[model samples]
Target: MPTLAINNFNIFCATLGGFITLFGLVSYLFKEKYYLSEALISLIAGLIFSPHATNWIRPQEYALNDIEILDTITLYFTRLVLGVQLVLAGVQLPSKYLKKEWKSLSFLIGPGMTTMWIVTSLLVFALVPHISFLHALAVGACVTPTDPVLSNSIVKGKFADKNIPKELQKIIIAESGTNDGLGYPFLFLPLYLIQHIGHQGQGSDNSTRVAMGLWFGEMWAYTILLSIVYGAAVGWVAKKLLHWAEERKYVDRESFLVFAITLALFIVGTVGMIGSDDVLACFIAGNTFTWDDWFRLETMDDSFQPTIDMLLNVSVFIWFGAVAPWWLFAHSPVIPIWRLIVLGILVLLLRRLPIIFALHKKIHQIEEARQAVFVGFFGPIGVSAIFYLYVSHEFLNGITVDGEIREDAAYLKEVMEVVIWFLVICSVIVHGLCIPMAKLGFFIPRTLTTALDSLGRTGSDSSDDPQPAFQQAQAGESETTDAEDRLRRRPGWSRTGGDSLPTRVFRIGRSLMRSGTSSADANRAPGQAPLPVSSVPTIIDSGDGDGEGDASAKVDGKSDGSEVSTGGGGAAPSAPALGEDVISGRTIRFHDEQQQQRTEEAKVGQKV
Candidate 1:
């Protein structure tokens, strides 16, 4: 076959691979249970067959050479696709949304990083003993950053409960977004030390300190701070440009200019100047530019957002499939069978357990706890992991002159490749499988429980009376009446005009309701109120006779009177009968007297 035909064939394979993977993912979106599995299968199959297909079409001598032609082709496609997808991801993120959900994001960081560190440490100590502590730290750093692409794909939005705090969702998304790039420094620093630490000595120490300082200070902190500032500045400028364009009726021209300028500044300028990992700069720039005004522009369509995202997704995944080192599966010496198994188990446990423990106190529900666990465990090592290996190998290879450091370089390269490859493969499989299972396990139950609880609460609160009225026949001693009155006067039931009688009835009936309800429900009954007997009203028919009776009648007649009158009335008011208003439908009551008592009690409680 001709070379042109072979190249065309390889391109065709790439396109086909892209199509299959995307189709499966799209199908998964539509609730197809097997879609993810099918997608994974298709992905694996394409990875295996696409190269052979390309080879058959164009049998070149150097096709499978050191750097596979197939790999290079895929990598370029991946970068192109990822770039577009990343932009869309940025566009979709509204600044207001992030700000509102900042708390959840903050809460997640501690647990997430802790999990990464602990697991990485344990794994390095246990499995790869030959590797230094620094190397383990490097591995921890590499794996620490969550892969937004993988996490976003696996954590199905539809499965999540709507009531689940938005903060939780934002935390998950934001962590995934920022961490991928963050892990790069961690991955690079250790490898750098491993290679140069001994030879460079004091000078190396200084350089290392400088690099570390830069890594923490400039690249991490300064870059993030400046990106926000620059992005905001650019956004402000874009807003002004947009206003000018609108005033001049040059809206279309203005929009096009805005996009072009933003694309150049964010994607091209930042990456070109600072290096490829400057994704945060691009994100902040896009974020700042799209702030409130640009979104208001009539000509600026949101349709472009999804299209860009899809293109990026296709590119990133295809490249991932294409360039994946099949040789690592067959022959990386650094990651032997024991190491692979140990690392895999350690990574999963370390990544998840700490998050579970950390979040358990804050998240009350069991399902949320389970979700925290699942999300924690399934953090698949992704693009950053591979990127780390690539840079490390390149650096190490550059250092080796002749055979002097070749062994060490080769060993480091092998270790990086094997470990990364294992993670990638395991993530694709484990997370892919767990995604569906997690949906079935945690998300579904949590959603169902929330729905049921909400319905029950709504039903209880919407009833007539909202608290039960005591029966007239049940009127007894004043103490009994006082107890019942106290129950009625409890703060559990609000006396707003909007409240229905049935709701009150339900509140009161709860105490008399049959046993077998949960203890929590029983404790919530309105009858648990504590009020003085003197604060309760005693109901008397006109025939009940005695000076106390007249006084009680007068007290009952008073609109705001809640306490029993105790002046020198006949028979000392006869100790006020209990259940005085048991069945009196005309009676409406509140805790006016009890409230004063409660204030005093509260003050006492506070002092105590």
Candidate 2:
């Protein structure tokens, strides 16, 4: 017999690696891909073929005898995965969009989410009379946060047809990043309600109200706002410490982010232990970190967040499938099948329409009503929801109101659970299916779309033409710049900020070098500052329609390298420059007069 070698962790690693590898194969095998979404693939695979190496029972009863391990899995993995993602999402969002479209974003994530939660709560109460109202509301709030993983899978798939509006997609991504954190208050409301309900029957009004105030008011309200404040504090604090450490030669320039990432994790753990919500804190932290847009870039955009999210998300999804009681459909003799179907449909349907209609009246940045409707409906519950679902399970399992255990506690827990599982299945399927039909038309009325368009200012998608705005500038052009601006792109200095693989890494490194770089390593010369690659050289447009003008060159040079450095410019990952390592996309170009003077006047359109 072939020797079998695997443990729980190893099985998990194998599943994650194997699924990811298979996804790559599927994607490459069929260039014209349709059904190879990573999230979808993982979910299906988990359902069919997980190792079940842990406490999970073979038949998929979905029982929680080993709640501790499951909770650990959900808590630790979700925090690490979702925490970093939330932060990256916030940091990487273009500041211009935040400023220009704050109103629209607010409408999308704020009132839109609240309205959906409220509607779902109402529907749950109306349809499933047996489930407690507060419990239903908790699930409502739980489901309110949209899953970007699912939405992105669809938008990125062949089904999107490149017609999925960019602005709309951005709004969805931004809103999903936030709504999970924001929606937690409602989720907690139910648990608190469950605690209070039995106590209220005991008729200790003063005590109950005080307990409610402590949990709901102080813990819930004050904690969320404080987490936001704490988040802002972390960003500025990290930067200050980073500067201090670098200036003191305590850390290497290349390892600067080690300090920042450590600070983030510390802040998260400390905040959570202190009784404030850490998820909200971390999300806000990401948004607040590197308030400057230039510093907000992810070092390796292709490999960083995408890779982390995929591994963590895919593992969780598959594990969820492995543990998911798809058998619930069969064992759910407690709730009628028709009711479950109706509840699931109502949960999904109630998500979009109301929010879009309400938001259209005030959000000027929204290009169309149908577009808003499309986004509102696209609110699929994902990692965060999964985290909360397990949390809800933990919160609801066992324990009766007062000392006397409610006989129906088991039934109530399962009933509430049935709704959640149904929602997950419905969301994955419906949202996934709807991707193909996205281009057909919006569900909103044409008259409503026209009215919203007339009432609100019209918006256009960003230009699709490949040439970047900087390249549009005339060469040798020197213009007055704001004293506070740090942009390196001026005449004579062409900024190819997209140098090498990690723009964030290089950008930050370049900034530190300019600020007096000091390496901690003893082998290297102590205070060597690495000079930045000047902007990419382009034909100087002489402000003429014929592209024949040169603006005055304002050279802002910062170099400890009086010894001229050659081959300085950085390369974009997809767009390699001439004379560069193709695999790494690294390049060498002149940034200063010392090096530039020797540079030949290379012909235009020549590679490198």
Candidate 3:
């Protein structure tokens, strides 16, 4: 008796139709900070509708052949989408941008990512009973690789700037983008161990150590080394081939460029099927194709890649909903839903957040702690996690154990399915709500509470407070006016403050004058005294030893911190002898009464 069978065609149509409908709704009614977006709506609809349509959780048993075929098809779709993402992420970003954010990049890929994996795994082991450490860690590792497909909604300036630091979007985008490709080894290694660890000796007397050596030499090497070499070679060949075709005028339509991307992805995936790492190869090709000597390689348009990416992404989610034992998890006597929610909270609050904060020494681009916290919250374990979970279940599907995750593939499958589905579902809702909350400024009061009451601090607001202009610019938008560039160009801050700009001057910190160009009324924080509409001549830092602000900002009666007035005549303020910046907040400028009087006296003396 087959448990569930929707046939491949129906699965495809449902995902495609649902995706179209969801996007249509989002486009029509959900543009504002007020409404729910396509991603959330699609997920909810799929959870509610896909399963019943497919007979997913009924007593009928699926044929082994049908199940395996469906699994293989979905697996390919995952690879295709992942391949496109790798190419899009790698080719689009300049090497210089990576260099600029290397410190953040280091932490994101290394400690920050790893620690989250470890912490979340430990929490799962503790909370989710009947799961072995290896399986738990595998789940943890899967979740650690974030998809963040819809993350742009909040990070690209949708959140009210008060709760979210939009600048952190660069880190989030780059981190999520790179890690999804890089996480293959971590995800697969444990599953390999769990499936083959104790059984290796049946073929030959293979001990754990021997098995590990073979696994490392084979899987790891293919993943790290061969994959890179093959991908780069493929990239080179494709580039030349496209150039030749273009020269011969065979390639005329821009839509044909989709083939260029899809072809490369297909080649990479084929190599993986032959035992190389699909992800690493695609990622390498993505980067390699974008290099200088590519002769204007055929590239997919940014808009097209996402649309293509969404089709597969939604298919996986909808398919998961259709096949997964949603009824069992909700009604099953094995694990209560309340306990599952508690575990989710524990991992999210304890495991997810603290690691980000602890890694702050490296991720300096986050100017405010609240920003780092917001990024932490929106770190949704999305499509890639689902892909890895499917792979894990395939490997661990039939195995059973007496100690923890018992025999009975159905039970084990249900457990893994429940945990993953629950986490992702919760993430979708929590992450979805946060965007609107940010837009509505719900976090502003929370920000005050965290800043003053929790931290036990008080401050007056100055122009140094958070600036909307400092937030990251949208694609194709001009970045020349952004504070990101301003901070990065400064030398010392590159290693420390993370695209550092002296942002706010609270009451206790320093009195900051309004940017000469900004409207005073709009910049003020709630519960803070209004800044005078009379604009102070803002010292725009032309930056790096160009003493320009010195000449322009010095009002005759006002004191530039490093200047003084003589009684008889105004003497020029001596330029700071060192090119080294004082490593202070953008220093506030004000005139003392004594300096004002001396300037007046000097003026009188000059008149005489």
Give the winner by lDDT: 2 or 3: 3
Estimate, for each residue in 113-150, the C-alpha lDDT of model 3 and write its tens digit.
Answer: 88878888887778776777876777787778767465
TM-scores for all candidates: the values are 0.59, 0.65, 0.62
* Rank by TM-score (best first): 2, 3, 1
Candidate 2: tens digits of C-alpha lDDT, residues 300-320:
333444555566666667766
Taken over the whole model, the C-alpha lDDT of each candidate is 0.50, 0.57, 0.57
Specify the highest-lDDT model's number: 3
Positional deviation of 457 in candidate 3, in angstroms? 32
Model 2 alpha-carbon drift over 4 Å, by segment: 1-10, 28-32, 51-65, 96-101, 154-161, 164-166, 199-208, 242-264, 298-302, 397-411, 437-608
State how far residue 156 of model 2 sits from its true place (Å): 6.0
Could you report the Cα RMSD, in angstroms, for every candidate shown? 18.6, 17.3, 16.4
- Scored by lDDT, model 2 comes in at 0.57
Task: Give per-residue CA lDDT, model 1, range 1-608, as digits (tens).
Answer: 65555465675566666665666456534333332543244346446544544432222332555453543444334334334434434444555544655555555555556567657756765686476676666666656666666655543333333333544554555566555445555565566565456343422353566556666775556655565565456556765776677688876754654463346345535553554454454445555555553453433444454344444444455445555666565565665676787778767666666765666555433246666765567566665455455555556666564445555455655666677667766777776676567557876876776567545544564355442334321223111233444555776644443234534454344432322122233234357654333333332222121111121222222222243343325223222222244324725332222223333332332222
Order of models, best lDDT first = 3, 2, 1
RMSD in Å for model 2: 17.3
- Which candidate model has the greater TM-score, 1 or 3? 3
